[model samples]
Target: MFLFRWPVCCFLLAFHKSAYVWAGYDVSEVTCSQGLSECTVADEMPLGISESDGADVQMVTAKVEVCCKDNAPCTLCLLVDAELSIHVGEDVDKSHSGHDTENDREEATISTASVTLCYKTPPTFPACKRVDFTVCPTELKQKVAKVSLVITNPAGVSFSSIVYIYPSKALHLIEVVAPSLNEVCSQNLQKSIKDCYMPTVNSVINQEMNQVELKFAARHKVCIQYEADGRCQSWESKTIPLHSVTPCLCLQVWDDDKPRRSQSCPFKNMGFLQKNVWQNLTASVRHGRMNNKGQMLLWNLSAPCRLEGEVWPCRWTSGHHCTEIEGFRQQLENTTWEQNSNVQWVKMGVFEDINLQLSPCVMVNLRGGGLHLGPFCSHHIIAAARWRWNLLAVAVLLVIALAALMSCLRHDFVKKWASHSFRGGCAEIGRKGHVVLLSPPDIHDGFSEVCGLGSLLKSQGFSVSVDQWSRMEQCNLGPLPWLHSQLLHVKNLGGRAVLILTRKALGLAHEWSRQQPEALQAGRGDGNVPQSPYSDVFMASLCLLLVDKRQGRTGERFLLVTFDQDVVQPPGSLPEPFQGLHLFQLPSQMKTLLCELAGGGNRKVDGGKSKAGWKWGILDGWKLKTKHTTCSQGAIPTQCK
Candidate 1:
């Protein structure tokens, strides 16, 4: 039986070796022959066995032929099942008669049943070309998941270490422990994972189970309403957070026992930020009020804010109706008065109608209800006690002062009267008599009038001469020789000379009298008289006043006129000798004065009435008068009359 069992066992062994049961390829010994060609060898021999145990073993070899079109590189692989067990200590001779053999072998015990062997010339494309990909469901939680990919070339190669499957989480954990490991492992894992994972284990655990819940508080609105019972009731409501799953929730409440005023509320004290919160609350209340019209009571309670015109009365009686409370009319009028009071009162016209009834008064009623009269009303009444009395006294004094001032002005305007008499008979002056008007130089208007008077006197048949004595350049009387000579000549010719002196000329005469006393006193009737050159001129003319008119009073009489043309009256008394001079103002009525001097006669002395009449009369009268005076009463008139 031992002999028969041995042959049977040998036969079974031979069958097992020929049947092709899978023994995993030796990965360490595998290699590519050319480029991509594949080959397999089966040998009926044991590859590795303990020599001492004498166990039989068999070996298989896969030859990978690698080739590329036109020398392009390629890849080759050999596959085997891991379920075939290989003894730990195994060796086999792979030498063949005509084939070169490079042998390296290893046996491994693996948990999974199948494994593959690979042989590759460095691939023409990169080995397991680095692939970048994106995955879905951006958010994720706990679990191991699969990711799929389609590769370009997946022929005879079976994946082992070349292609690996890993949980990104496990790889991450491993990376924490072994830092030197390629960071690509963790990076790939993160790329493959759908969810973000917390780095700390504790944080991840906490986040996975419990989430935080947040709650917000209420915003409150408060309103006060007047009740019929004369009590103010306050209604307060608060808005709850809408996100909370509760509706119609009362978050805050307040009750009022007495009437409350809006002004009395604490809201007024709350500054800007708090007031904004109140505004927000009121806005919500207003929204609620709008939505629930039927629930007016509730709406009022919700309406913490008041509308601009929404004040309500507490009671409803006949006299205390809402209308009786004043429909903004009284408020408007009061506001107008308050704003306008500061404006200044304007008097519209010279006599504005003022109301005494509306005027402010000082009198007051006594505590016993009796009215006080007159100015004794108040100690502070300044107008009645002091100002009125002072004003009346001032008015009376003003009247008396005004009357006295009028009397003084009247006295100034009244004309004063003067009396005088002539000692000599009146002279009948002929046209041959001459008049000389004198004036100062600086008073041009006065000098002009003197010139005009000379012309006027000449027209009236008098030989008139004007002496502008004030025009003399020298300050001394010696320069006035021509004036003295002319005066003497006119005097010798028996002609009259009128000296018209102005205020300035009168002043010069006083100065001349002081400087030239002899010339001033030459013609004085009495030595005691104050002398003036003007007096000398007058005396010379008086000596020549012995002419006679053919008609009227006839005598050796002369008119000596010393007229002052200045507006001021002469100062002090005139000398007795000068007093006899007929002084008059320069006649303002020139035509009337001329007519009076012409004796109202249209006819000339030597001819009938015509333009020639006045000229002829003046020439004839001069001749006749000169002859009549000089004839000594008996000779024929030698000069033509």
Candidate 2:
């Protein structure tokens, strides 16, 4: 969460910008002021590389200053966790050729390192704290390894800052003779073509210095890599080269515009060097080794050019006049007519191998030409492989996360784990114990009965809570866990819950519930009474039972309503806690059952109906006749009294 506060406007500077809110309060303001000196990698930090149990030693620190709304009522407690990401280079596909410093490469790997930048809750807003996240390898050999610092707050806001970190290996710019651009054409002519190394260029190539300057043929630019102050500045241009084959930079040959840290090689294309203002005007080679060496050449020469003098043929993505054009193996040699005469160029060839020339590949900045293939060292295959592996690992983690989300969306089963239990109070004492009806929406008959039962109970002075009626709108804020909390609240009120069983409920339960009966026999052919409930209903019911068991409560305050001729014998086993304990099992009985449960009622039942309920069941039946009822026809027993 990069926060740039516009107090009145209330804007947060991040990918998602909107009115800011933290916890539940409206955000008034947020500000960040960096320290006098930003955190950077230093050479003094690591003497040499050391691997501990197959892991490289890391050594770097990260810091930041964060402030929340100052005029708020109290200090906001922010819980933070951090991650340090370091970029490492992957191999240029064998089909192609390449490019970071050891630690400053382009592709990255999340450290196996366990690092977290943490601090105590700020006693005041606008807090300043120095957080050290993780250490990264200091032996960066690639061009520039990218390092990013990410800090996440519990409220779900994340702040990320990335800085490029270079390796400890020193960089040197040298001018070496390039391979003949016409090697293939020359070999065809049987001409023994040899390299032409300028005497001045050869001397500059063998020099053992930390920094050197060089001069190049006109109309070209060079990308130089080196260390200034403490950090690595890789591939930055100190001169400018141009297209259209004009000699504008050649005009500066006498300007005395010496290269300090001040030159801007903006025109493009450069090569060859020695140590004066003119020498500073050219490019360099990788400092240490030979194979890791570069082909000394400039980039972005305009057209009056073509491959075989036809179209611009090079493997790298190229341009015709400033418009980029490319495809797999789409070379200038293969392009048709008009396209050939129109190609414009940007970057050209690069760091030359002092001993190798016009090899199968010219070490050009495949992007253009104005580039420096990293330091002259054997490309580290291990580093490249690890970088690719990191990408795969991240992809796997994303797949797992996506799957979990899909589960939560398709069924209530997974939603039950959404931390709803953390909001305790489901068992608060004082209210009368109520009956909870658990069933799905598809089971119209069962849900109707459950609702009827609830009405009957309310008439008897006992309260009732129905899972479906809890304003699903408000509860949407939470998942099945929140809905389950409501059901548990009902259970803890006093009486346990009642589950309406049906083939539809059973089939869904088979899929959504964590545990199931050893076997299930379908009751689909039974009757019109067996209506299936919605998955949401099953979700709440299953969670209630599980949550109840987890709380370790006492008593079997539940009742199971089975609707078979022999409703006493259920088709499958019931979910635990409600598993086995002789309690009133309503087998095809409805109102009479409610009366018996409501306190002042007869304890006798016959043929799945009360012969004569004795008290409340009769009165409730009469009340249903006089008042509104969900199902009126044949619902209440006519001979209640």
Candidate 3:
């Protein structure tokens, strides 16, 4: 009875501890073949077992199911303890030491075991059947125990009944504000705020309140708050009336008090319309009375007219009528005319003379009326009349004075001065008789040649004189002076003058003719002579020659001569009234005539005609021997010898 009772008591104690362990666990009633629990365990149990030395033992297995989130690893812990002790006999221990050692081993035996179970795939199980168990009979007598198993399912396990939890929800809020006025809206805000749900708070607040009269309130509570708090020191508020917007034009206008002559307008705060109206009105007023100004009345219209210091009333007159009536004389005068009120007219001319007393009107009447004339009127009329008569008188007086002066100063002046001063000096030696030479001073070579030729003529009993007019340094000498002096000199010398010229002098002569149209047209006593004869002495006989020093067919020096039949005419075949005079090249046939003149002469040669004695000899030699000589005429004729 004692032995049976002891085992019973031990079993009862073990069962009691196991009941406490199961009390802490939570289990599900709907357990599938693989399902989860809040807590679980695995155990090994042994029953009806004894040791060889009379020791009793039992084995038991217990497991606790630990639940975790699906797809996460789980661990289970099992509690194990010994339920009974083994007994060993003393005699058995002396004869055979096994009983005593068995009892000791039973006392030192462990009651716990641990196992690691890893689940690598999903939907892992915590069922009792899935639990792995192993028991050893020798180990069972030591103790019966519950062991812990760590089950890891890293790949996860899913359960239909498990509660799912989510992470917390939190966010940041951003508010964008815009300006009160659209014009002042921030560019960034205009881009960001797409929805109009957010209200725009105005920064400014009005302090004035709407007034209301109370009628029936017995008890009332009123809250009055200053929009700006105590910051407003003195409260005063009013509504301003809105003004109408107006369009404007930019313009400046002059004021009444400003000086009329000032260039800048003096209007202070004039609007566009007022300024423009004022400008138009002022312009009209000025235009109407402009001509009444004293200065305007005195203005010279013939010259450039001016308005407000700027050129105005621009017009030009060529005096074509005056020109037509006076012919070439018109250019020497200018005339302008203006009409005063009541048909009274005024005329003016520049640089003119007036002889009012000689007019057809009574001298008293003319003197009383003052000259009624335009700016250039008196100048024009007086210049025209005075120029005509004064020019004639001056010319006549100059001519008379020049004649008397020349007579007084003549006294063989050329013979005493320039006759022997030149190379080949002599009175004359040429076949032509009494030749006088004249030329401008610049052509010294031509002058020398003329002197030499004159000397040569003097040697042959011909009188020759080379005279020059005194050089006038200033160009102010009037036409009358030049003409009178030159003409007087020519008449004194019995009206015979020869002008020798080079190419350069010929060009100058042509230019002079062009510049003086009146002189070119001035008629001479002989219609054949140019109107304004520059040289007092015309070229009665002209010669031009080119001497060749190179050898000819006979190895002797030769001479080439050219003469011009049209020397009186300009280069082109234009009609008389020639524009100018110029020496042009003569035809080849003229060369033969020139050669004849130079080489042939028996008597004296004059005006292309030969005399009997010396001219006849010279003409015959020129025609017969020197015609085809091809040698210097000065050289002795080889054929003749």
Candidate topping lDDT: 2
lDDT scores in order:
0.27, 0.31, 0.26
Ranking by lDDT: 2, 1, 3
Off by over 4 Å in 1: 1-429, 469-481, 510-572, 575-577, 589-641
Superposed Cα deviation of residue 143, candidate 1 (Å): 99
Q: Which ranges in model 2 have alpha carbons more than 4 Å from their true place? A: 1-432, 445-447, 479-482, 511-537, 543-557, 562-578, 581-617, 620-641
- Native-to-model Cα distance after best TM-score fit, residue 189 in candidate 2, in Å: 55
Ranking by TM-score: 2, 1, 3
User: TM per model?
Assistant: 0.20, 0.24, 0.18
Q: What lDDT score is found at residue 243 in candidate 2? A: 12
Model 2 worst lDDT run, 10 consecutive residues: 196-205
lDDT of 1: 0.27
For TM-score, the strongest prediction is 2
**Which scores better on lDDT, 1 or 3?**
1
lDDT for residue 441 in candidate 3, whole number 0-100: 26
